[model samples]
Target: MNILPSYRYQMADHKKSILIFYVVIVGLSLIFGFSTTLIINGNDAAVHGSTSGNEMATVIFLFVVGLCTFKETFLISLQNGVSRKTLFTAKLLTMLSVAVIMAMIDKIFFLLYAAALSITNSQVTASTFYEALYPSSTAGAGPLMLHAESFFFEVLLALAAMAAGYFITIMFYRLSKTGKVIVGAGVPVLFLMAIPWADQYFLNGKITIALVKLILTAVNTPSHMAVTCLLAIVVFNALAFTLMRKAVVKQ
Candidate 1:
């Protein structure tokens, strides 16, 4: 059984969902873009027009896509006579392709918004999710290179999220009811205990400072962070595949 055809088929199955997501993103972008343009045009003061919101929408899209794709596809593919290994490979390929395509669509929307602003003679400041997340000071690179870097970084993040979501779904599927209850109760309790303990003892009661430092580190060295994220994605996917190898399809 060829995996490419299976991957393509799976992707095609989700085309409608992808299209709806694209439409929602474009609609939101247009609303923000035009509203900012109109507001700035009406103002007497030299207020800078700013269009923000796409980043949040992009994140939501990636996260929801990641969360929904795995369990459904796993069961369906398994029932269709596909081997676990092939299904795993196909799912990985599908996630990568979707991530790349969505990233490109995100960049296109940014360009389109800029062009729309130009046409309306509006001096709006537009920034992508990547730019907002990882602002840099030194800039000798061309726009193309910067966009490419952003695209690559976003793709890695999307893949990592997808892998984590898939792993969670598989774990949920394989767990007993009592096991689920323990996990559901134990995780939040662990977090509640750990956060305060870390803040009080380890962080000198300055959780905010620790968080700020972490964000600054990530923003300052995005390339290194991207590599770290990719490594995490590989590890997550490996574990998910291992779990799935023993997963029995539910009737």
Candidate 2:
């Protein structure tokens, strides 16, 4: 039998044309980061460098990549004779794959740069490479490792964001006059549900901490954050697949 049309649609998307642009942007960031360090510390570049900025950039990069994938999903769904479910599944898988790959490349760059610095400074500690990629919690920032077990939670969160965006778009398309009000109302509704906050009566106090710990254990164990990230890839793709399978295609 011929391959599914949904998969074909993903392959046909033209946004891959932007891949070169993303690569150039990332390359420039890397060079700029390295150059900034060299400028600040003179020949002793290790003394003034940081991966935190790059890490944040990677996150932003992933978000943009997510948007591109969303565009593909939307276009695929609009195709004639294509099953909505199949279109969704294919695009979800594509997005998850792209996210995982980008995350890995980002982490690799972070670790390599960190390791180089640590070696140059002769300040190596018991901290593993994962810690290098995701620094310990400190003021003003949270842990950043999207590893193996916690992968499910993070990726699911991302997929939820994507779905939520698409749903709002659909709602707006269907209800032009009330679209703004509906989207404004729907955004906060979805945000409160997906984001794990402790002030709520249901998620407050020790229960919240317990849930957070459980999530940490799943996504990151102390050694390989990649595993958690991979798991997330699977989970998010699965969720997107399910959502698409059940979505009602209009027009």
Top of the candidates by lDDT? 1
TM, every model? 0.87, 0.51
Per model, state how many residue pairs clash.
0, 11
Give the per-residue lDDT of model 2 (tens digit) for 144-163: 53333233333443444444
Per-residue C-alpha lDDT of model 1 across residues 15-56, encoded as one tens digit per residue:
998899888777776777777778888899988866642645
Q: Give candidate 1 regions above 4 Å deviation.
A: 52-56, 197-219
* Residue runs of model 2 more than 4 Å from their true location after superposition: 1-5, 11-21, 43-47, 53-56, 64-78, 111-177, 185-251
